[model samples]
Target: MALQGPEELGEPVEESEDLDDQDASSISPAEEITLPPGPGGDEETEEALLLPWDRFSAWLHCICVVGFDLELGQAVEVRQKYPPGTKTSICYLSFPDSNSGCLGDTQFCFRFRQGSNRKTSLGCFLETTDRDAPPCLKQGHYYGYVYFRQVRDKSLKRGYFQKSLVLISQLPYVTFFHSLLKIMAPEYFEKQEPCLEAACNDIDRWPTPHPGRILTLPIMGVVLKVRIPTSYDKPGTSQLVQSAQRLTPLIVVSSPPPPPPPPRCFYPVFFHLQMLWELVLLGEALVVMAPSPAESSDTVLALVSCIAPLRYCSDFRPYFTIHDSEFKEYTTRTQAPPSVILGVTNPFFAKTLQHWPHIIRIGDMKQAGEMAKQMKVKKLKNLKTLDSKPGVYTAYKPYLNKDEEIIKQLQKGVQQKRPSAAQNAILRRYFLELTQSFIIPLERYVASLMPLQKSISPWKSPPQLRPFIQQDFMKTLEKAGPQLTSRLKGDWIGLYRHFLKSPNFDGWFRNRRKEMTQKLEALHLEALCEEDLQKRIQKHTEVETVDLVLKLKDKLTQAEREKLPVHPGTLEKLRAHIEGVILTLPEDLQGILHKPTTL
Candidate 1:
């Protein structure tokens, strides 16, 4: 464990041979004491005695400073539980300057400082007749620091603190240690070899320190000895009582406080499961190690609660992906990316704790609903099929590139008595291609809208659509439906029948019958009108042709009709009619007859 600067300076130095008797006795350091070695062949180590005012974060100070048992002692012993490889700090907590009503920026504390001359820093001093009196004990609480060196030099040290600093609440170091080793040297655990030495060799060859690599063998032993009470009954005092009762034989028990209310944030047996949840949120297809019940323990239950959603993300589990070691090996037998190559935990896992936030977030029902909503979202309606769209107005614009000039000429020709055929033909071809192109996209646009509209129609109410869109679709049923109804009915009915047969499309297919009927009826009316116009044009042409043949029979003389030379009287009529009939007659006859005869 890394030491704080002050902690190193305060290491026990036997009375500096050059000091005065009173001063030297008061300054005994902590590390000089000897203790029995446990089975591990390692001497137990202890930390300097500390007070409530010791160097700790504000959160830690608040957790340590108040509400404790104080009858036989004036200070409460409290231990800090740190992550693996981090040392446990056993400090004596007490309320100092009790006269002060509220806690503020400059709270009281005392610390031992080294150097031949520096004085001890303490929040308060207690007067005692027998030197063991608790003058600072008040209102059922302790209010001073204990000098551990003096108590221990008298061979009266208690709890695990007599030898080593291990918090009762620290996590089991072995499981965490293996989890760390897996992150640092994954291939070692993946090997089929059952020999333990290979795993150790792999750990020895680890390239660098992993994020969770703090749990070393030595720390594992200390963590094993820690025995945290299963319950918390108060803010700061209950844990102290638990430790004191276990370590020292001298603790007196008052009635224990009722257990603290259960917090809603505990997520148990979910280390790897939570990790997989993170990948799910990231939308990654990465493989991970499967979660197992044995991976969890009480020590990290609070931490798991902090980092995982617990219930909100449960839906993501079915989609979570993972692979075993053999599979990973088989796949990587060819090639693997750099990220996959690194961070291998047990050949099967490229799982990492990187970028996981320090604090856990609890997800709400609304957030889950939003996720489901995204899943519910169908592709939007094809706006191309939407009526009154800008696309309709702009439809002919692309083909109108040279149309302005041509249109101007056609209008001029109309204003004049005659139009040029060359210019008219050019304009006609341009419009034909423009009409052709528009029909193709329009048909495609309508076809595309069909499936999209069907898919989204059911989800339309809450996520509302536009007025025309929301209303019943395609309401173009003729005033009187198709007079010849069977063909039109068959076409629309075919569409509805096809829709009904599809799985899961019943609701969308529900209104198709009425809509298709309306559209087909409208189309039938247009077809009937077109047919009527063509009949009128054909009838008018037939009447004109018969009239012209009758006129020819009355005026042409039989000789002209038979193509023989006409009589002078008929010739005179032909001459008089020549100018009017020039356009209608054969060019040769008109040219020869129209020539002036010698008068």
Candidate 2:
């Protein structure tokens, strides 16, 4: 609700004034009219009016223009939404750094993923703000894809129109969002608010983005085909829909197009892939310096995606500027860099972030074909960005030896004039295999923590899981690590020890523990269902029977709340059995039990 400019110049003025004229009535200059929720009478009509953010698949939330107004300086010029009362304020997202010095540049673009420093649930986050205003989705973060454009006009006081088209969304589908912005930004500069509304309507038609299913998304007369990844997917396996397959033609196409191939973002840093892989897996701080924002974001995203199947638990900003709030904290020499990956286009960062351990400086990847034709596999030099060539620059050595076979394969592909997509597939498989090999020992160790199924009992609480001992796991790893299976080997034990201290490892372990605990609960419920309830009740003393009934009721309620899977009619049968046992007791005792329990 903090609309950052004067009422006359506020982003909502144009849309509101236009509506007021059409209706022949007065309306507030700053507030948009909220469309009422549709009734359930007509499903197709309701679906047509549904806002993109209101949909279950809510890939987009809001669209706005952030620019330099002659009078207001950096301000949100105009904002447009379908239903218009989304409640969430994107004013803070209009500009990332209050003092981004590079704003004067004629043409540039960058992206930012914004969220709270620490994770919190919906209730906790809502408590700190106006309770009525909630985000469109159940998520803690949102992404902003910005396209900045400036041109000389020589007719106005500043003699130029400078603005950025900002697309805000809850989804982290980086490649898709950026590609959509590419199609909309230039056209919006020529036309205006109508274009934004058209784009939003197109987005509303997209189906729910369930993981692993192919999605056909149409926007601005182009249709994109993609598949969002699930936890089980390997790196580069999920296509982010970087390219549009076709225009929406009158003739129907028979077969759906294939999903867009994963981007070859790693081609620029091909020689130092293994070293970068080690840095990413250990969650080290890295800075990616590129010729422009597009390259910077792509490279940073690719680096983060290196260890897929294992989520990158640490913070990462695909496009970070010197104007960012954390600029001072990240650049100060007194402390080491935090575990993060930042993409930057400014030359100023080369000096400010000089103390950082790892840096990858890359040129324009648009000339990837030319680079492939000219270059070959070569040794890398120490990372020096200020006056050095584009290459990976890091002093820290890697634990595993570089796999010469993979290198040879990639180099051969490059020499053969093979497409970037083929090179990407080959590299993706290598990393996927590497991650699996590294994780096998950890998987084998955690599987040993489960209590034996036969040890479960209907008359007692479920057995606790065995605790994970690092020393015991290391001893196991010594005998059965990647050394037995991997062609490239160095200090597998050392690598595991290093990774154990990272955020990714902690997150993975917690998830595994939660899953195992749930399985144990389900097994306990199964055991109770299979027991002869009447015989078991008769065997126990009166006091013991009462205690068992109360505990069973509590456990059943919890299992239902958690939606744990159990045998059919398991809960209903137990409840009926409890009722029969209580009725068979003395009349006075039955009354006493009935006062506190329900069957």
Candidate 3:
């Protein structure tokens, strides 16, 4: 497990922009705790040992936090009192370094405990209200013993106890410690303030495998390793053993040192990047964390084994495969996210993409100009492209209908050796392949992503952003761009790498307004292109129809010799073939052919 430290996370924490309207400064420093003068004159809660080295008087708090392995929206800790579920699991990170005593700076490693292998009863002190009712053990809770020994052979009978502990917030020890952190280091114990997904305003909109969110806790530590222990192996300095628990201390698996953790968020030693999903989709895992959020912060949260990976997919299987080492038995106690594993073909994922704020059309000026020309042909302007729908695999609907009467006039003029009606129909049916291939797809793509432009972004709109959020505010405050962004190129890849990594969090949001404007312009341009396409295809079709008319006239002379009527079958067959040639041309051409015209 490549545990992350503060230096590795490099992210300074910030409150959610969504909560900006709420009093963000509501957090006051934790109330002062008075330490009882004991043998060492140190303050120690019944649950946590105080660190005298730091003035903050921080407690070495060992918490029973459940990782939000599969939490859809809210933080998993909100379910702290509840039993673990699909998106929630028991993760152990604060291992007791026997050598470091209580407060010393010691290395940390993160491990996940495998869940119950079988349905077993948990025996606890439960009082039955009815005399006839029989005593029964709870089905899911884990019961275990925790040992505490005095650093020095001091008070309270050598200060050692093998106390049975229940992993429940309602339990005394659990409550005391939870209360201790709440009172002392209240920031961590306060409501879990996870940053929103890059595009979504809340967890309700979070999409799986969309982008890696930087999960940061208010506190900081380094992640050493992630392990799922199997057999009874005592910790480095204790005789503690277990049948199903894997919270062993300091189990190091040496590998060629992994690269430093990403600079976006400060991850505790317990959690690290499980998988770089984009690479996973491409069947690889290059775990060097880049693409920091446009927002500067030092913490990212994560859950392991809660959500399911896209099974049988080489791209996502690696996420399940990454564990401590071969020495330890790997565990898969929870399933991956349902929406993510459902496959890219899922309509929901495409819908999710629409909400994601950073889909870019990286086309340069030349491409934009070319697209513009398609939208509005100066000589042949007819209709706009924006009216049609967008897609590769999403909702798509056409916007225009071919003029049937015009086609009939053109076909009649040709058949009767007349020119005017034939000319009108030919001109109207132009851009045969362009509409089928380029126009509709471009329309679909734009329509699919239009939802992003309409989404309620946390960063204010440019007009709204001007008063409170200034562009490049960091330059005024820190004299440089965001640290992570500075390392990236100044283009779409850099901006797209992490939408939040834009110069200022607000700047990032406002920058998108420009793109949205361009997208709208493109939509209008598409409308123009649709019109131009019709005109151009009509011009081309005029030539083809004229040629066909000449051929028909030649056939007429031959028919005059053979005394055969103009072959209706041959004309119908030609009309059918031409009808299927382009996306919308068939209908117009067919109408022209099938309609009767007097010579």
Candidate 4:
């Protein structure tokens, strides 16, 4: 609602009661003007008097004076609209002083009283002895009038009334009788003079008192000052002075403190790692082939071995070539690993690795191998790696130069097989001898290497030697066996099909197959060690694998460019299959397989 201005508060009156005449009279102004006993007033005692006009003025002032209401909340603005009158209900008329001249600042607070049907606007006013007239007015005299109104639902309604009067023409009497007694009990009022004086002085210079005394009292707003004496000079007197000061006009009330803020949420590390792995898997494949002078051939080989495998797994197929000459030159110029070169040169790989940690470590090979074995036994026990198939082994098979000779030996062994009992005995004997001759020695060797291997910290040790040993030593043994045997056996058709179709097995049929297998084997062995080492190795493998995959990827690209349709399709299919296999692998393995780009 809009606020009303001073001009809108009340209407001006043409006439008022003759307060000036009543105030000017020297003789007893009314029948109620009875003088108290004094040394020279009267020789006999006089009856107490009652003056209707005087009582009316005093009552009007008490009700309508522009002063604070402790129970109600509002500011008082005193405005004299009419002079004092003889009318009992309407003697003097004045508005609450909006600007409490030299007293203190106040605010208008409106409250609706239940069942009273009245909306009251409460406030306070400051009276000053600094006025032009004497400190107080005489008894039976009227000074001013006041009327209060409240705003209710946008309408102004009259609430209360007050009329200023001079029952006594002294500042001390007017202040004490009208203000002090109304605000405080006589006892407290009498004792707090010094405190009130000090507070009044303190607020005299301020434009408006902040944290004013009236604020400490209910519905009173804030008081700036009060006139009182300062008679406190002794030590204990100061304490009493302070207590009295705080008791009324100099009251203090403090404000409350503010509240605290909310908490933050974040993604966990495992989830972050998973997202990174997925991104890396989506990037281009890389493979490193042996350097050669023929750029096209080298590119084709690398692509076939590396890029083709991952291309099938990821959505984006990247094909590029690094010629043997270029590779050699690059390597010679920068002594970093092939993987580092790939990571640096390829933006996709570099970006992916920015989120993934490097995991490759020395002990990873044995761990990886063991893990692979356990996984195979648990998930694919019926399958074989190679050399375990029937009709594939014989004494003359190794010496023979043709496939026909191996087939002949296998047929002869089957046809001339011993009677059932004799065959069983021979098998038992063979098993015993085989365990003693080969398995025991292999076990012993591994056992011997255990302590030295265990001593190596994955963090500080060099890359595991398992891949080189497996490829060079194991493969040599297989190749030089007494007979040429199939690497796989026993209902192996399904296993072979699965292995060949798997993304991990992509490009294995090519010359790069041996190298990839060796690398994979080494990684698998490493992962078989401690779980921590396995994790580290898997990370490393992902990086190296990505590099190798990308290198072969370039070859696949070259093949595609040369319009080698059959080779390109074959490479693409293999890449897809290998990628699928890699996805199926454990998280650690997958992490190893998928290397993100490095920064």
Cα-based lDDT for every prediction: 0.23, 0.60, 0.23, 0.25
Best by lDDT: 2
- For model 4, the superposed segments whose C-alpha errors exceed 4 Å read 1-37, 40-62, 65-141, 145-149, 152-245, 250-599
Q: Indicate the TM-score of model 2.
A: 0.71
Clashes of 3: 53
* lDDT-best of 3 and 4: 4
Which residue runs does candidate 2 get wrong by more than 4 Å? 1-53, 56-58, 70-74, 80-139, 147-162, 179-187, 198-268, 364-386, 538-550, 553-557, 560-599
Which tens-of-lDDT digit does each residue in 459-573 have in candidate 2? Answer: 6788889998899999998788877667887988889999999987997798788778878888988788777777877878888777776777777666654546567787677
Worst 10 residues of 4 by lDDT: 256-265
lDDT of 1 by residue, 63-164 (tens): 111212335232222222112221111122122211212222111111111122112221111111111211111111111111111112233333211211
Residue 582 of model 2: what lDDT? 76
lDDT of 4 by residue, 273-392 (tens): 122222222232222111111111212222222221122221111112222113343334234322221211122222222222221100111221122222111112221222121111
Lowest summed lDDT window (length 10), candidate 1: 390-399
Q: Each candidate: RMSD to true structure?
A: 43.2, 8.8, 34.4, 46.6
Candidate 3 structure quality by residue, lDDT tens digits, 460-559: 3312212222233322323332322222122322322332332222332343444455444333322322233334445566557545444444333333
